[model samples]
Target: MAADDNENWEDRPLIMPFCGQSCWLVYQTLERALGRSVIIEPGLSWTLVRRQDPNMEHLAKITKCNTMVVLAEKLIEESFDPIVDRHTRNNMIQSVVYNCGSNFPRTNFSRFYTAILENDGRVISAASLRIPSPEIAEIPFIATSEAWRRKGMCRKLLEAIESALGDIGIKRIVIPSSTEMLAKWQIKFGFVNVDYQTNKNIKELNTLMFLKTTRLQKVINPITRKTADLNFLPPSSPRLPPAPPSGQ
Candidate 1:
């Protein structure tokens, strides 16, 4: 299908940065572009968390809901969901699209990724990496389907995106979260709360977090090319800046 044709299937206005096709196509594009094979186990099956993988093990053991983490890196291709009826899935997608707004085409510098349930080709979670400059990339709109909560899908999607970004030398990640829970989760994943001054355009509900792979205390200005403390902000300081002009 043409890229334009797939726009309607998206839940939000933001354009996905990778190949404008299925999640498998995006995965393949990342692998080829980064020159590293992307390996994600296929299937929605469950497995005992290995003791060596303490983080997963801890999460698996502590959850009160008893929802086992679906043990897969990527969803299996062309699988079908036995439990979710077609009507329910369509309604869920429609609700998400309605709430998320009109289609916004992606730019060359930005990339998008998603985690899907192999059964029925359902997108369980998604993320975006926007490269405003060579040294910095912002991760926006990390969302998971309501019906697929606590399944470890978001975590896997994040891991895949971060790994790809790191491999390509984009180490700093700017994430604007909409809730305290999300902020705490980002912190747990190594992001630090910058607590920068709030942008007038952003609602009071959101919080901003920044993270760097290296210990360097300085961040270079994307526009000026001058190095400054990581806390620096542009004059506009409009929280996370909106996506660039649609056509660029």
Candidate 2:
């Protein structure tokens, strides 16, 4: 399992359904390693609205900003660094939001998951899932607070988002991930390198690597058909099942 944004997660842990004591311990381990206070809560719309102070402008910004079309506006405002950042991972969420929001309008902002925990009334160490296209939700970002680095928080958070996605009838997931860690996760999660590209001068920017969701893919079944050779088949015959042989 992995973590995604929605740190203000509800009173639920996003770990695999069958995850056991060891997994729970991992969460604690991460907390201890980061040495930052963390709480996982659901990213409720009402909660986000209430969290946004009475600054009408900021609310409007959230409402009108093209970037806010998805759920990562808050993260972007918090300032994102693509390099040396494990929690935030790459700016995958930002890139997905920017790309889609740049083309779509703000009112179309649909429901998505972001795992966030309130720290002294300031939301921090967040991650988000973009359902721009339902069948293929994109994990754009999964970041932990600077003080919260080296903790297993990010992975735990992603598991939470995946649970939400499953409940919502989503399947076939995709994540924009770093190339270096790609191999590590591939070994860990069975992901494969489908494609790769790059940009020079960009530090730690993942030019390539995508993590596919096996859980999500299982929800879909492929349609199959059998083809017959025209020359081998009897002319003008319907492709029907053969009749059973006479009983002895």
TM-score (C-alpha) between model 2 and the true structure: 0.39
Candidate 1, residues 89-203: lDDT per residue as tens digits?
3222222212222243221211322222222333455443344333344554355666676777666655555544444444455665445455455555655544343122122
TM-score for each of the candidates = 0.37, 0.39
Native-to-model Cα distance after best TM-score fit, residue 30 in candidate 1, in Å: 5.8
Q: Tell me how far the alpha carbon of residue 220 in candidate 2 is from the true structure, in angstroms, after superposition.
A: 11
Candidate 1 residue pairs in backbone clash: 17-111, 17-112, 80-120
Q: Model 1, poorest ten-residue lDDT window?
A: 44-53
Cα error, residue 154 of model 2, in Å, equals 0.4
Q: How many residue pairs clash per model?
A: 3, 31
Residues 180-205, model 2: lDDT tens digits: 55665566543454322211211122
**How does each model score on lDDT?**
0.35, 0.36
Which lDDT value does model 1 have at 206?
25
